[model samples]
Target: MSALARNRVGQYEVASDLSFGDLSAAVAAGWRDFRAAPLYGLFFAAIFAAAGIGLSYYFYNRGELAWLIAAAAGFPLLAPFAAAGLYEVSRRRLSGDSIGWGPVLGAVKAGDGQLPVMGVIAFVIFAFWVILAHTVFGVFLGQSGLGATPLQTLLTPAGLGMLGVGSAIGGIVALFLFAITVVSLPMLIDREVDFITAIIVSVRVVQLNTFLMLSWAVIIALLAFAAMAPAFVGLLVVLPLLGHATFHLYRRAVR
Candidate 1:
């Protein structure tokens, strides 16, 4: 394959060959980045964890804990935004620049208005996911589970069908979101490009490395869910680790 172009249009060349070794290295580098800037990682991770905890608390108190399944599935949809700061930290570390709160936070503004645009896109997708999830829940469980415990509700035949259908839909939605933003968010942080161009490049990267990138998406989802199982504390470590790792992955996947 020809080398990726570094042209004038702010487009990046996608790497044609990305192996599992590259993924491991990116994760290792992410760990190093986190170690190098534990405070920054911890700070961002704390905010993410707090939000998860807050949502869980809010629903659990209202006797609607079951709805958390949908929220949890959709929650990571917003991760690219939470990762905005972590990407900044990794970028600065790689460039040998000073790592400070001001500069790291300021990196969100580095995209020249594209970051917020991406943020809006992410929020809209999340909103859609939530609404769809609610509809699915209603269609399957409806008032049948009104007085039942969350666990009891999920044990019903209707609940099982809903789970099956909902998982299939959520998986497709998450994969689509992943392909578009996987490289785009970091690309925006690294360069100055409109959201449209960045998304195109990102989707191209995933298309070129479909199996490998899908494996990456699975790893991220699994790790994130496992982290959330521990009262959101694991996110203090997992989110930063994954966030930093993603930036490094973007570095390897894009030129």
Candidate 2:
């Protein structure tokens, strides 16, 4: 929690004149925070990484591409809460307080039902994406009976069209969810506000810093893609770093 941002009545005072340099600075500050509290970062990240790896192994060995796609679409929904621990770490460090796992865990658990509220939003958005993806898959490729000849089917016109349409639709869903939740997760953690207020504040911040926020969003997506390769091992580093960086961005962007 921010000391200067304390005593909230669920209303936010958004800041302006933020630039790309703030993003750069936030990354640097995030790195410093990570280095200072490497154990906390690693502990939280490892849990997420393990879950990702386990899911990948199960889906791959079972040849469940449909399940994989659905999981992929929904898995990112857990992302906001993955940083709850990191936010506590950053907030404690910011306050010159000594760090302890027990205290940090307590702080996260004591979120006053706000994190679960945000999680519901994340899951609902993800569920919508999965439903849309499945509908697209069924529309273009369902009657072809291409499940037996997957490699041959993707090159066909219908399959290719489905891919194009799904990509466009998925991109829009991702962008919308990103805008709504970009800073709201951290904001909820730091402020005494409802999810709606937090989400609105987050959207306003992104709207004010449109290009820079998009750049940061792209940065996050690229990192996420790279991390998913090699069995999600890279998330051990990337997720925590990005999560920590997001907390710093929240601090900078939210006054």
Candidate 3:
């Protein structure tokens, strides 16, 4: 079926023989496009960053410390669609369209209906991730609750163990989710395909070049972690960078 396919939606992307070199080229192209139209990227990223700020402020006031990890990790999961506008920027740049907020945002609004379906998938995964994270903490560190500050939990042996265990489990979930969305969002925008097909192709592409894709995942994780260091301000830059990069990366991953 893959061999007989015309559109690179489900099955496998027969046109692609992706490699690590593609990842490198994608990042470079992503940076070039971002520099060309920084405003588009900034506009979309700012919306997400502001939401981050709002959530942080709300949680801080309410003293919902346990929600912190989920909030931090979940934003990245939400990035695929949140950065739809940025992806549209990359699409416009590739097609030589004049970049304007009206047109770019309109393009995003006009994207595939399947985009929202993908969002539902992300929401489920995020909810599961948060629940699992809470469970890990509860099982390992509940006896001697981490207090005053969340960082204080790391001081104990059980706390350290819980962190280690939780991180590993979270990493697995993150990778699986990444595989399903890595190329799917851009593909959904670029083609007339359903979300399920896009997701299958996305997973197949990752399987075809597992090591390269895994490296891309690691790079995304590191950039995201570093970006959070500046109190979520860094996401303003990191989100768009990765968003635009993922578009170009998808191009290389499929026909």
Specify the highest-TM-score model's number: 1
Residue-level lDDT tens digits of model 3 in 101-178? 886776554445678778788889988998888788788866666676668778678878988998898899999899
Residues 88-156, model 2: lDDT tens digits: 888788879888998766655435887777777777888888788878878888786357788788779
Q: Provide the overall lDDT of each model, using Cα atoms, as 2-decimal numbers.
A: 0.85, 0.77, 0.78
Per-candidate TM equals 0.93, 0.87, 0.90
Model 1 per-residue lDDT at 117? 87
Show model 2 residue runs off by greater than 4 Å: 1-11, 144-152
Candidate 1 C-alpha lDDT tens digits along 1-255: 334452212546678698999999999999999998898888888898899888878887887745777788789888778888999999989999888899888877867889888888888988899889878988887767535466776777887888898999999899999988998998889887888988988888888788999999999999888988888888888889999999999999877
The lDDT of model 2 is 0.77
Could you tell which candidate, 1 or 2, scores higher by TM-score?
A: 1
Judged by lDDT relative to the true structure, which candidate is superior, 2 or 3?
Answer: 3
TM-score of model 2 (CA atoms):
0.87
Best by lDDT: 1
Candidate 3 lDDT score relative to the true structure: 0.78
Ranking of models by lDDT: 1, 3, 2
